[model samples]
Target chain A: MSLTNDRIKQRLIEKFGEPVSGFEELYGLLSFEAPKEMNLKILQFLFDDDELKFRFLTDLCAVNYPDDKGRELAVVYHLHNLVDNIRLRFKVFTNVQEPDVFTASKLFSSANWMERETYDFFGVNFIGHPNLKRILNVDEMDYFPLRKEYPLEDQTRIDKDDAMFGRGGTIV
Target chain B: MSEHQHHIKLPEGSIEKQTTTLNLGPTHPATHGVFQNILELDGERIVSSEQTVGYIHRAFEKLAERRPLYQITPITDRLNYCSSPLNNMGWHITCEKLLNIQTPKRVDYLRVIIMELARIADHLICNSIVGVDAGAFTGFVYVMEYRELIYEIYEEVCGSRLTTNIGRIGGFERNFSNTAFEKLEKFLREYPKVLKEFENLFTRNRIFMDRLVGTGAISAERALNYGFTGPNLRAAGVDYDVRVHAPYSSYQDFDFIVPVGNTGDNYDRFLVRNEEMWQSLSIIEQAYRKVQEFKGADAEVFHANVPEYYLPEKKEVYTKMEALIWHFKIIMGETAIPKGEVYNAVEGANGELGFYLISDGGRTPYRLHFRRPCFIYYQAYGELTKGAMLSDAIITMSSLNLIAGELDA
Candidate 1:
C-alpha cells in the first residue's frame, strides 16, 4: 500500500501529540515541525514505524530566520520512503542564540557531512555530532555566511555600481 | 645478528610503523577537479582518507536570495557544468511550480529532449573519465569527441556550449531552430557507433575489469543510509529513479528502463551509466518523434502565455509599449510572486537534483536550497576508499564523478 500524507500525519500526531505541529501539505509534500529536542525521537519514530519507513535522508540543511525570536534557525530534513516512493519533510526550529539540536548522524550516515555543512553555513550547533567543525567552508572563517544577518553581496566592493545592477534603480 | 643483540629486545607486535600521509589534491591532475583528499597510506594501500571540498564555493544559495528569480538560472548553470541544461531545466521547473505555471505538452517534450541529451553528455564524460583514470586514454578521447557533438546540439539550441542557460520558467526562451534538430539528428546517428566502440574498448578489457570490478564497492543498505541516488544507488541494486517514481516534464509518457547493478563498485557504476546513456538516447528519439507529430498551432508554440514571468520577444519588445514594459518588469522582477514553499526534483545526470524554494510574495526568493547529488554522495568517499589500494582509490573517486562546482556549491 502507498503511504499517504494523512496516515503519516496521524501516526506522528498519535506518537508525539502536541510537540508536532504546523502540519502542512505544500505542493503535495507533507511538512511539519517539532520541538528541537524531539528531533531524534521523531526521526527514529519515522524510521522505525513499519508504515512510515522514511529511511532515505534525501536532504539535510538549516535555514536562518533572523526575525523569528526563539525560532531563528530551522533545520529541515527531507526523508524518503523507497518502498512507497513517498517523501516527507521534517523540520525543527531553535533559537539563534542557543541553536543546539541533536544530530541524526547515528540514524543516517549521510547526516555527518550535511550536519557539518549546516554548522558551517547556518551555525546551527548539532549536539552529539562526532566531528562537527566545518565541511564546505574553511575552518578559519569565523562567521556563518548563510545567516540573514550578512548581506548577500560583498559590501566592500567599489568597482560595481548598485544602480547599474538594478538594486537602487527605479524601473522606467 | 650482532647489531640486533646490541639493541634491547622488543615485545612481539609492539614495533610501531608510521603510515605515509599523502595529499592527493586540491589541484592534482588525477583528481579531475579541485578537491583535496588526505590519505594515510600503508605502502600502496590507503589506511584512512579525509576529503576537503569548497575550493570553488560561490555561495549560490546566498546569491539566490539577492537575485531575481529569472537571473538565478545562470547560477544553476555553474552547479554541474557537464550537464548544465539539466540544471537550468531543473531550476525552471522549480520556478514554474512556485508560480503554478502549467507548461504545454510540446514544451515538456522539448525539455525532455534537451535534458536527455545533457544526460548523455554528462554520462559520456563520467564513463570516459573512468576509462581515463583506469589507464584507457583512448576511450576518454573517443567519447570526448561525441561530447563535443552533444555540445554542438546544445550550442544550436541555446547559443551556448558548456553552461547552457537553456529554458525559461514557462517554457523555452525561443522555438527550437531547424539547425538544432539537424544537430540533434546528427548526434543521434553518430553518437551510438562511438558509444558502442567506446564500450567495447573498456567493457571486456581484462585490465579495466580487474581494476574496477571489486574496487570501491558500497553495499545497497549503506548507500541508502547515506542518501545515494541516481546511477550510484541504482548501481548498488536499488531501482529508484526520480523520473520513474515521480514523473516530471513528460517523463511518464516515454518508455525507458532504469538499469541496475549488483555490487555498486566502480565497474557497476560504469555499466549503469553506459546503459543509461542508451536509455537517454531512446528517450530523446521518442520525444523527438512526438515533437514532430505535433501539428499546426501546437507545433508553433514554445513558450507559454505567461507574459508576467516569460520575457517578450525582441521584436515584440521593440514594437509594442506593453511588451516592452512587461519585458522590463520580468527582467527587473517587479512582478509579484505567490507566498509559498515548494520542493521540486529533476533527475539530473548525477541524481535527484532538488530545489527547495520559499517565496514571501516578493520578487526574490526568501530562501533557496539546492540538494546537489554530488555533495551528498561524496560524503561516503572516506568510507568507500578506506583500506583500498591507492590506484583503486583514484579510480573510485573518478567513478563517483564528483564535480567540484556542485560539490562546493
Candidate 2:
C-alpha cells in the first residue's frame, strides 16, 4: 500500500504532538510546518520511518516574510520518496532577528550549499553548519538581498524614465 | 625543491609537506563556463577543492518578484540557455497551473515536440563537451553542427534562436510554420545517423573510457542525499524521472524508456545522456505524429481559450476594438492572477527545473524561486572530484554539464 498524507500527518502529530501544525494540502502535495527547533528531529523521523521514507531531498530553500513579526523567515524542504513516488513539503519558520535553525546537512548532504544559499539570501543562520558562509553571493556583501527589507530595484539609479516602464510620469 | 631542502634541514618529523593551490578558472575553456575551482593538489591528484560560483548570478528569483508573469518568460530563457524552450515552457506551465488554464491536446503535443527537441539539443552539448574534455574534438564539432539544425527549428517556431521564449502562457505565441515542420522532419531523418556516428567515435575509444569510466563516481545514496535529479540521478541507477513520475505537459501520452546506469561516473553520465537523446527522438516523433492527426480547426488550436491572459491576434488587434484592449491589457500586465501557491517541475535536460510560484492576486508574483538542477548538482562537485586526478576532475565537471548561468542564478 502506498503512503497517504493523512497517515504521515497522523504519525508526525503523534510523534511531535503540538509542535507540528499547519497541515495543508496544496495542489495535491502534502505540506506542513513544525517548530524550528524540531526540524532535524522531524527530518530524521521522516527518513528513518519504514513506510514514510522520504529519502530524497528534492529541494531546500527559504522564504522571507517581513510582515510576520516573530516568524519572519521560512525554511522550506521538499522531500521525495523514491519507493512510492510521493513528495512532501516541510517548512519551519524563524524570527528574522534571530534566525537560527538547525542544519539538515548532517542528514542530507544536499542541505550544505542550500543552507549557505539561504543564509546568503535571507540571512537565516543554520546552526552547526560546518561552512555556513555565503555560497552564491560575494563574501563582502553585508546585507541579505532577498529579504523584504531591501528594495527590489537599485535605488541609486537616477538617469531613468519611469513612464517607459508604465509608471506615471510627464512625457518628454 | 633545493631551496625547500636547504630550509628544512631538520629531521623528517619536523618537515611538513605543502600541497600546491591551483586556480582552475572562472574563465578557462576546460571549465566550460565561468566557474572557479580552487584545487589543493598533491601533484596531479586533488587533495581538496572549493568551488566559487555566482560570477553569472543575475538574482533571477529576486528579479522574478518584480516582473509580471508574462515578462518572466524571457528571464527563464537565460537559465539553461542550451535548452531555453524547456525553461520557457516550465514557467508558462506554472502560470497555467496558477490560473487554472487547461491547454488543448494539440498544444500539449506541440509542446512535447519542442521540449524533447530542446532536451536533445542540451544533451548533445553536454555529451559532446564530455568528448572535448577527453581530448576528442571531432565529436564536439560534429554534434555542434546538429545543434545548429535544432536552432534553425527554434528560429522557425519563434523568431529567436538561443534564448527562445517560444511559447506563451496558454500555448504558443504563434502556430508552427511549414518550414518548422520541414526542419523538424529533416532533423528526425538525419540526426540519428550523426548521433550514431558520434557515439561510435567515443563509446569504445580506449582513451576516453580510461579517462571517464571510474572517474568522479558517486554512489546512489550519496547522490540522492545531495539532492541529485535528472540524468545525474539516473546515471546513479535511480529511475526517478519527473516526466515518468509526475507526467507534466502530456508526457504520459507518449511512451519512452528512462535509461539508467550502474555506476554514476563520468562515463555512466555520458552513456545515459546518449541513450536519452535517442529516447527524446522517439518521443518527438510520436508527439509529432499525434499532432499531425489533428484536422482543420483542431490543428489550428494552439493557444487555449483564455483571451484575457493570451495576447490577441495581430489582425484582430488592428481590426477590433475589444481585441486591441485585451492585447494592451495583457501586454501591460493588467491580467488578474489567482491568489495561490503552486510548485511545477519539468524534467529539464539537466534535471528537475522547478518553479515555486506564489501569487497574491497581483500582476507580479509574490515570490518566485527557481529550483535550478545545475545549482543542486554542482554542490556534489567537491565530493565527486575528491581524491581524483586534476584531469579527471575536468572530465567529471564536463559530464555534469554545469551551466554557470543555471548554477549562479
Candidate 3:
C-alpha cells in the first residue's frame, strides 16, 4: 500500500503520542510541529521505520516570528521518502535566547552546511553540530542579519534624506 | 666552514611544515566561478580540503522579504543564470500554488518548451566545459554556437536573454510571436546534429575517459545522504527526478526518460547530462506538437485570467477601466496574498529548485526560502575531492555544475 498522510500521522502518534502536535496538510503537503527537544527522536523514527522511510532531507531552514513570545524561532525541515515519493514538513520551535536544536548532520550529511546556514541567518545553534559556524556570512559579523530585529535599511544613517526617498512623506 | 653547508641555511619551521597548503580559488580560472578551496596537498594528491563559498552572497532571501510577488522573479533569475527561465517559472509556479491560480494548458506547453530549451543550453554548457577542463576546447567552442541559437529563441520569447524575468505569475508576459516559433523550429532542426558531433568528440576519447573515469566517485547511499538531486543524484544511480516524481507544471503529460549512471563519477555525470539534453529535445518536440493541436481562439490563450495577480495588458489598461485599476493595484503592490505555505519545485538544470513560501495575508511574503541545489552540491565538494589528484578536483567541480551565483545566493 502507498504511504498516505493518515498512515504517517497514525504511525507518529502511536510512537510518540501528544508531543507531536499541530498536524495539518496544506496544498497536499503534510506539515506538523513538535517540541524542540524531541526533533531528533521524531526524525530518527521517521528515518528508521520500515513503513515510513523519510530518509531524504530535502531542505532545512529557520523562520523568525518576532511577536511569538516563547517560540521565536522555528526550525523547519522538509523530508522526502524517495521510495514512496512523498514529502512532509516538520518544524520545532525554540526560544530565540537559547535557539538550540539537535543537529541532523550525523544522520543526513546535507544538514552540516544547512545548519551552518541556519545558524548564519537566524542564529539557530544546532546542539552538538560539528564545526557549526557561519556558512554564508563573514565570520566577524556579530549579529544574525535575517532576524526581524535587523531592518533592511539602516535607520540611523544620515547620508540621504528619508523625505526625498519617499519615506516619512505624503503618499505619492 | 664547508662550502655547500655555508651557502644558505634553510628555515627549521619551513621543513617542519611538511604538507603544502594550496588556495585553489575564490578567483582561480580553473575553479570557474568564485569558489575558494583550501586544500592540503601531499605532493600532487589532495590530502584534505575545506571549501569557502559566499564571496558572491547577495542575501536574496533577505531581499525577497521586502519585494512583492512579481519583483522576486528577477531575483530568482540570478540564482542559476544558466537556466534563468527555469527559476522564473519555478517562482511563478510557487506563487500560483499559494494563490490557487490554474494556468491554461497552452501556457503549460509554452513553459515546457522554454524550460526544456534552457535545460539543453545548461547541459551542453556543462558537458562542453567538462571537455574544456579535460584539454578539449573544440567541443566547448562547437557547442557555444548552439547555445547562442538557444539564446536567440529566448530573446524572441522574452525581451532579454540571460537573467530573463520572462513570465508573469500566472503565465508568460506575452504569447509566443511567430518569429519565436520560427526560431524554435530552427533550433529543433539543427541542434541534434551538433549535439551528436559534440558527444562523439568526448564520449569515447581516450584522454577524456582517462581524466574523468573513476574520479570523484560517490556511492548512491552517500549521494542521497548529502542531499544530491538533479543530474548529480541521477548520475549516482538513484532515479529521483522532481519532474517525474512531483510532476509539476504539466510535466506528467510529456514523455521523457530520466537517465541514470552507475559509478557517480565525472564521466557518468557528463554522460547523464548528455543523455538528458536528448530527452529535453524529445520533450520539446512532443510539447510543440501538443501546442500545435490547439486551433484559432484556443491557441490564442496565453496567460491565465487572474487579474488580481497577473499584470493587465497595456492596450487593455488604456481602454478598459477594470484593467486600469488592476494595473495600478498590481504595480503598486496593493493586492493582499492568501495566508498559506506552499512548497513548489521544478526540475532545474542543476537540481530541484524549490521555493518555500509563507504568506501572512500581506503584499510581500512573510518568509521565503529558496532551496538552491548548487549550495547543496558545493557543501559536498570537500568530501568529493578528498584524496583525489589535484587536477581531478577541477574536473569534479566542473562535472558537479556549481554556479557561483546560485551557490552563494
Candidate 4:
C-alpha cells in the first residue's frame, strides 16, 4: 500500500508538535504559516531535519490573498521531496507594512530564482537575498503584472508606438 | 575568483555596481519570447539578470476560462507552438482524466502516433535551434524541413499546420487520413537520410562539439532541485522520464529507451535530444503500424456531451431535434463540462506537459493551469547563463527552448 495522506499528516504533526495556531492540511498537502522570526528554522526543519528532506521545491509561487481579513499578500511555497514522494506546502503572510520574508536562497539555490520571481511578481521582498531584480516583465514599468489591481492589458490595447511593444523594444 | 556555482555564491560584502541595466527582448530575437530580460552588466559579464514578461502575454489561462472545455484545446496550441498536437492532446487528456473517460484502444493508439510524431518534430527544432545558436544555420533548415513534413501530415488531418487543434475531449475528433499515412511513410523513409545529414552537420564537427560539449553544464542534482523535467533532465543524466515512470495515455504499450547524458552540458542536451528524436521516430513508426491495424470506421474517441458543446453534423441538425438543440447549445458554448479538477500530464517534447483543469459544472473551464516544461526549464537559465562564454549564452538559451506563450502564461 502507498503512504496514505493521513499517515503524512500524522508524520508532520509528530515532527512539529501539538498545534498552536499553526499547521493545516488540504488537498493532499500539509501547510502552515510561520512567523517571519522562526521562518528560517521551520524551513530548516522541513528540509534538513531527518524526517523531512523536502529537497524539491516543485513550485514556489506566490498567491495574492487580498481578502484574507488582515493579510495583504501571502507568499505560497509548494515543495515535494522525492525521498518519500510526498508533497508539502507552506505560506508566509506579508502585510503592506512589512512585506519581507527571510530568503531561502541559502537553503536551495533554485530558491534564488523562485524568491526573485515572487518579489518581481508580488513585491514580497526577500530579505537577505544576494541579488534580486525584476524577471519576466518589462523593467521600465512600475506595476507588477501579476498583481490583482494591475491592469491586464493586451499588446493591441497598448499603443503600438509604446516602448514595451515598440519595434525597438518597450515603447516608453 | 572563477565564480560559477549556478546558485548565489557571491563574495561577502559584494557591492552593487552602479550598473546600467540593458533590456534585451521585449525585440531581441534571442530572448526567445516577448520576455524583457533586464541585465545589469559589470562590463560584458552580468552583475544581475531579471526577466520581465506579459509583452506577448495572450493570457491563455484567462482565455481558457472564457471558452468551453473543448474550446480551450486551441489555446494550448499557442503554449508550446513547436508541438501543438502534443499540447492539444495533453489538454484534452487532462479533461478526459477528470471526466474518467477511457478512450477506445484505437483512440489511444491514434494519440500515441500523433504525440510521438510531435515529439520528433519538437526535438528536431530544439536540436537544430541549438545548432543555429551555435552559428551553424544549415542544421536548423534541415530539422525545420522535417518539422514541415510533420506539419504536412498535421494538415491532412486537422487542415491546419501550426495550430492543429487535433484532439477532442475523450479522443481525436476524426480519423487519421490515409493521405496522412502516405506522407508519414514517405517522411519516415527519408527522415533517416536527413537525420544522418544533420548528424554530419554537428555530431562529428569539431567546431560545434567544442562550443557545446562542456559549456553551460548542470548536474542531475541541481537540475532536479530546479524541478527540471523532460530532455533537460535527461541531459543531466537522470533516467526519470514521465512516459516511462508514470505511463499515461497508451505509453505503457511502447518500449523505448530514455536516452540520458553523462554530463549535463549544452552538447549533452543536443545529443540527448537527437537520440530522443530518433526514439520518437521509432515510436511513431510502431504507432503508425498500430494506427493502420485499427479497423475503426466509427469514431475511435467519444467526446464530452456533444449535444451541449459540439456542432451537430449538418444532417443531424436538419433531422434530429435533440442534435439541433445540442447544436444551438454548443454554438453558444452553453453546455456544462463535468464538474471536477484533474491534472493530466504527458511526456511532451520539452518534458512532461501537465494540464490542471478545474470545472465548476460550467461550459467553460474555471481554471486551467498549464504545467509548462519551458517555464520550469527557464528557472535554470540564470544558473546556466552565468559564467558561460557570451557566445555560448545564445546556444544555452536556445537549448533551454523557452517558448514565450508557455513562459508568460
Model number with the top TM-score: 3
User: What are the candidates' individual DockQ scores?
Assistant: 0.55, 0.52, 0.53, 0.18
Full-model lDDT, candidate 3:
0.92
Residue pairs with backbone overlap in model 2: none
lDDT of 2 by residue, A1-172 (tens): 8888889899988889988999999888899998899999999999999989988888889988787989999999989888998889999999988999999999988888888899999999999999999888899999999997785666555432233334333555
Task: Give model 4's share of reference contacts.
Answer: 0.29
Off by over 4 Å in 4: A1-6, A17-46, A49-53, A62-78, A83-172, B1-26, B29-32, B36-52, B296-314, B337-339, B360-363
Worst 10 residues of 2 chain B by lDDT: B8-17
lDDT (Cα, 0-100) at B268 in candidate 4? 90
Winner by TM-score between candidate 4 and candidate 3: 3
Could you tell me how far off, in angstroms, the CA of residue B360 lies in candidate 4 after the best superposition?
A: 4.1
Candidate 2 residue lDDT tens string, B1-409? 8878677566565347578789999999899899899999989999999999989899998888767788999999999999999999999999998888999989999999999999999999999989888899999999898999999999998899999989998999899999999999999999999999999999999999999999999998888988889999999999889999999888989889999998999999999999999999999999999999999888898999888888888999999999999999887777767788888899999999998888867667878989999898898999898999999999999999899989988
TM-scores of the candidates are 0.95, 0.95, 0.96, 0.80
What's the ranking of the predictions by DockQ, best on top? 1, 3, 2, 4
Lowest-scoring 10 consecutive residues by lDDT in candidate 3 chain A?
A160-169
Count of steric clashes across candidates, in order:
0, 0, 0, 13
The candidate maximizing lDDT is: 3
TM-score of chain B of 2: 0.96
Candidate 3, B55-92: lDDT as tens digits? 99999998887677999999999999999999999999
